[model samples]
Target chain A: MRISVDSDRCVGAGQCVLSAPEVFDQDAEGLVTALTFAPDPGERDAVRQAVELCPSHAITVHDHGQGHSQGRDHDHGQGREDGRGHDGVVVDDG
Target chain B: MTGAQPRVVDFPLRRPGEPFPPPRYDDYRRHPGLVLSYLPNGNRVWLVTRHEDVRAVLTNKKISSNPDHTGFPNISDTMGVPRQEQIPGWFVGLDSPEHDRFRKALIPEFTVRRVREMRPAIERIVEERIDALLAGGRTADLVADFALPVPSLVISTLLGVPPADREFFESRTRTLVAIRASTDRQRDTATKELLRYINRLVAIKEKWPGNDLISRLLATGTLSAQEMSGVLMLLLIAGHETTANNIALGVVTLLLNPAWVGDGRVVEETLRYHSVADLVSLRVAVEDVEVSGQLIRAGEGIIPLVAAANHDAEVFTCPHAFDPARTERHHVAFGYGVHQCLGQNLVRVEMEIAYRRLFERIPGLELAVPVEELPFKHDGVLCGLHELPVRW
Candidate 1:
């Protein structure tokens, strides 16, 4: 598994560091820095959870073994990508 | 459902120094995302207890933060009145493009990197306050001597307010946030005084720029004088008040559970357990939305009962127990989504350093008075001790 973080989109909430400290560490400003590019098999679940829990959706993980990348990339104006796939779920009550 | 009398829960469900969630909060959690009636104005608001539901409503774009919106649940009669009467610069009460614009502009100043750069200064501020406490004999009021000064000075430095003016700002802020403690007249006077003070500060920054937040905003030229004043006012009030209360309350919690001292887990759990700004995440449903199987209609207010959600038994095992080792990171103490507390990272840094250093220096620290006799700030918007008397 390969992991990458978008610093531009990162707000430094520190969720990634809390979730997978071994694979991810934060700089002085709290942005994510990968400690190990290829994390051990045992750390994959945590890394995946970190990616899912990032409030800004700033983490991207490419699982080479599965040949798929799981993450979303969008502008700040776009709402959060919770991975629920319900982009337009909210509607006007009127 | 028209004429049905709702079950009324008092707006602030906990008293000062009380264990959070009151005892009956668990009963409310059983229904998950049910709407409960808030007695303050008889407004029916969706009380989201489960973690998932709280996160959903906070992140939902259709739920508006504007207090002017119809059905917005006002927690107190005096509260929200100032905003309703005039234009509000505090982005906490705004939504979308406007909220994002203000937040984005100020984000750089609070980023982890930026806050890290401010660490040395923050550390010095902490040390000075600690020094004062130690010099004033064995017994001291932690709230006034240590907790309050550290953040107050740090924010003062950030705003470039002269050291001479710190007392002026601090006294006014104390009045502004204490809702039930102060009358509406007192709160309003403080609000005006703060605005005038900020306006004068902005004028000073304009002529002689400095390395402070106000000067940086002035350099950008994106905001007008009024807009800049509003933003500074928000930062000044929020920056010190919440962190000061947390520091005081955190010390009390640690003293009670000394085994958790020096544990980072204690900080997160303390925030979750107390959820100081308990009812802050109130939003008005601008449009109909379905969240966790409940269909919330338009014009209805939604109060994500953060204290209750943090204590929900399903997400947190033994939710009421103050176990510092619990690793739940999804608590809504600082809120969630676009409106999440911008100063969270800064607060965490301040708190971690404050707690660790405090315990290390005052190894024999203990409450000066019995817990039952200590005064808690029940009349204020933030939940914390009014005075934490301690001895070493």
Candidate 2:
């Protein structure tokens, strides 16, 4: 899974770092910083929970789903819910 | 959705000490959509109760939290006209731009990193308070000796109340909360003195800065001195009891659920479960908006009940029960969107330290009064304990 954080959108509540410290860290200003661009599969659940818990929706995830378009689409407002499953970016076979 | 008129219930049905958001909160959520409710003064409002709907109402820019708005739900007549006139920097009662200005100036001070750095200091405060609490006696009111002071001192530290002035700050805050008996005149004096002290603190931070909240806020230069004072006052006063009550209720909650006492999930669950400021998120819709298949027209009062939403059965299984092991659900307890509680990280850390330390140090601690007789503050903006009597 891929992860990203928007410093501009961050409210500094720190839910992301609190929920998934292995993958995310806050910058000196307290905005979120992605410690790793891609996290181990074991860390996916924690990252997903961080995205869900983020008050500002500052975190986004993209699963390596079916040959899909890949663009750094952080715009268009609340880009986290970009068609991937709300729980995670996993695509369904059905 | 056919032929269902918005159901009516008394808005803010006050069932104090009954665990706020009472069972009736379910009545609104159980309905397919928002309900029409009336405030005590007969003002009609749209009460958003479902978890998703509450999140929507808070996040939507069309909603206004400003008290001066045409449709804003004024809880009391006293809060009506004079609110816009008097209070300047209380951002909790403000909307964007005006609210954003204060939030922008103060956000850096409350970042997760800043609060993380504060953990050790917070732990020290908790330890000192616990040491004092234990030394006082085996039997004492936990609220008076423990719950209240821990947060009060921590907040003072955050606000740059130096150790020398800590006693003065505590006494004034205690007076403000009526934890100590004082006449209205005395309470008024306490308010003036605290404000005066805050002004002095701001001046000191301006001249000789330190690594504290007030100093950092002055460094921002984004807020005027008046606005700076307003924001600090809001943080000191508004930020105090919410955590204190959380600690008080968290103590009672943990005592009842001893096995789950020290778990980290317990903190998040406690926040969601009690949702102390149940109806604090009141708003007015600025533009037409649709929520859960219902349309909220502009200039209409609205209340997105956080307590009710936190307990929504759809999001949280067995909604009313406090189960740390229950799959944690993201709750709107600190609220959602631009106006989400800025001090959430601080509150989280304080509770974590307060609960873990208190229980670890005093393993034999238990409630002094029966559950039925405990004093719960049911009839206020904050639903918390009036006093938490306990024994070691």
Candidate 3:
């Protein structure tokens, strides 16, 4: 599994770190950082939960093994990202 | 159903029982979309219930938190106005870019690391209050004696407010957090006094800079003296009131269900179960926004009921119960999106230490009065006990 975080979208609420501290940590300013981009399979549930729970919809994950790579946040879209498929992997610049 | 006068409901939905968020909300959650509701000011607002819809409303950038917005619900006259957007450092009610400017300058001071550094002090302070509580006798008002002081002193220590003036601010803030319990004049008086006091502190900090939030922010020169005062007012008031209320609520709720105490998740569960500050997350549609299949037109107020979202049965089973063992811990008690509670990490550490230490150190700690006799702050934006008589 591969993980990525959008620092710009991050509001530093710290949910990511709290939920998946092993895989995520916040900087001095509180924006999240992935401690290890590729978290162990054991940490996948935590990572997935963190992605789902982030208040800003800031974190995203790409699970290569199961083609799993989406968050409940983006799935709803809320008209922010046009044509963004829920099942499709979301890759953005930053 | 066509002409049913839009189903008017109280915006904050005045507290109903042992723990609040108004049970009327449970029915609102089952409805298809945002239910039309009326505020204390008799203004219209779309009540956003359900975990999914609340999160959507929070994350939607088009929605504005600025209280001055035309569509913003008029809640200020009752629950202390959110200080206008023109107020330089009143970022609580400002939108992004502007809000980001202030938050960026302040986030470092409140990050997990900075808050963690204060752990020893928090622990010491909690212990000291408990010591004082014990000294005062087995029975006393835990709200004032223990819960209030721990966060009040901690925030004072952080903002560089001198101990001499702590009482002045604490009293004013107590009036500030009340819902309908306090008259508009009382809240206004408190707000003015706090701002005036903070402005004076800014002048003092300028001449004698110290190692604290006010001194540090002023030294950065990012915000002016007046602006810094605005920020400090927010920090000082928000920093203590909500956390203090949570501390008291956490204590009382745990006393009601002692088995929930000692467990680490009690803090989170308390925050969720008794969603104090539920009504503070008010916003308006700056542009038309869709939530829960309904089109919320521009210039309409929105209340993303934090308490309702926390208690959404879809997310939390048997939502009303205080179950720390619940799997989904993602409650919106601190709100969501860009304006998420800046002091949350600090609040968490304070609560964690307060609960853990209070239960551990005070062996026989339990309520002095029965649960029904307790004074709950049902009429305010922040839900908390007015006083918790307890005996240890």
Candidate 4:
């Protein structure tokens, strides 16, 4: 599974980083921007919370291996995305 | 369908003496006992105006403040909203047990001792804001200059709300509090924006542990996500809006009566006379109880008019005028009884320091605009000056 953050909603309050330090890091402006692991199998729980705990409902976690059944969509605000449909393959964006 | 209605009409819902006049409600003083007809929605309700009656009703649990009851009227209808807009959600609407429990959880954080420990930090925040105000020039809008920043800095620091998010909260609060929003659409829009902002902050606090109130709550797991949002919403509204209004109006009161600035008696007098808290917390009557010979049925809403109570002649000799030396220990500014404001101590210390430093730092401080020209949050449940322009 992989995670992507929507920059518009992030307030840079550093909450995402606190939930999952291994997965997210804050930029100079204090906005959470990127990931530490390409395919961090060990940090799945932290990544799940990092998305759930975002106040703005800006982060999305995508899962690839188990088809549509692999990851339950955590109904945050991210609806459908045009990016890669599967998880495991990491999409790196700053 | 219902039993015979009580003699609600005979209660004489109007004040008795001369009106309070401009800058003060003209009709508030004259007919202290007069119950004015006020409708928050389509439901007809009576507003109790006299000090004694308001206090009696506010402290009485028999008057239900909750919106779910048939007797309780919806105040959010003015904004044309379907569901009632729970402005200060959580305990603001609760009665007795639920109110007591939720408030108890956070009471320790706001105690005199806890707040006193924050004095040095609060003082520093005040000094910095003052520096910024003076830096901009000798003259400034007292609302923006002093009133706005004092509580903003204090609350943000205490809660560990990030510094960058401060501007967002400030802007959203200003928009939401102004009762003068021309249309219901505008008011609703502002409300949604503020709620969204708060929800975002809540999400952040959950993940990131800090020394703020939000972080503390997240760590303990005492409150659910919904409950936490409700409480934070209360803090955002109560913590800053009330304090900001008090500071603005307090400055106006002191500047108009300069003697009150330094005189301990006068400051006390100003607090009573020009109370920033125009209305008292809403109390819902849980059961039918008779007060002052009137049997107000169960579930009816009772609002304690703090302004009216402070001026009750039965309670004080000359109630209307601002007299700092009055030795009366009982004032309803922070309210009376068990559910009084938890942040009262913080508000008091902040106001005292703000006023003391304001006048001392700028000796010639005086209003730049006429009192008549100044704006106020007149129609709001909690009323005070909107902008206080001053020059030294």
Q: List, in order, the clash count of every candidate structure.
A: 3, 1, 1, 27
* CAPRI-style docking class of model 1 based on DockQ: incorrect
lDDT of 4 by residue, B1-392 (tens): 12333323321112223232132332444542334335544444545545546555655545655666675655434423344345443776776556655665575567445677899988898888888888998789888667877887788778776778877766666665555543666667866886777678888877777777788767667677778778876776787878888788878878888767866454456567765564445554567665544545566655556766677677767777777777563566766444556677687778888888888888888889988778765455556766788987
Please tell me the TM-score of chain A for candidate 4.
0.64
Candidate 1 DockQ, CA atoms: 0.18
lDDT of 1 by residue, B1-392 (tens): 33343444555455655655676677766753465665467676777777767777777778888888999877766334344333556777888777766776676677656778889988988887788878899999887788877777788777889989988877777676555457889988998998898899999999999988899888877787878887887787777778888888899989999889989877788888888877777788888876666767788888887887889877888988988888666678888776778888788778888998899889999999998988876655567777889999
- DockQ list for all candidates: 0.18, 0.40, 0.45, 0.01
Rank candidates, TM-score, best first. Answer: 2, 3, 1, 4
Model 2, span B1-392: residue lDDT tens: 62467777776656645656688888778888889877666667898888878877777777888878787888755222113233778887777666767777777888777888899999999999888888888988877787778778988999878899998998788777753355667877998899899999899899999988888777777788888888888888767888888989988999998989779888888999999877678888888777777777898888888999999888999988889888866988888877788899899899999999989999999988898898777545677788888888
Score every model by TM-score: 0.84, 0.90, 0.89, 0.69
Top DockQ prediction, candidate number = 3
Per-residue lDDT over B1-392 for candidate 3, one digit per residue giving the tens place of the 0 to 100 score: 33334555655546457347667788888877668877666667999889878887877788888878897886766654553445768889888888997888887788777888999988888888888887888798887777777887888778888878877766777677654457878988888888888888888988999898888888778887777877887787777779989999898888888887789988788889888888888889988767776777799899888998999989899988889988888899999878889999899999999999988988688888888988887655677888888886
lDDT of 1 at B110: 78
CA-only RMSD, every prediction: 6.0, 3.9, 3.6, 19.5
Clashing residue pairs in candidate 3 are: B179-B380
Better of 1 and 3 by TM-score: 3
Error of 3 at B131 (Å): 1.6
- Fraction of native A-B contacts kept, per candidate: 0.14, 0.50, 0.40, 0.00
TM value for model 3? 0.89
TM-score of 1: 0.84
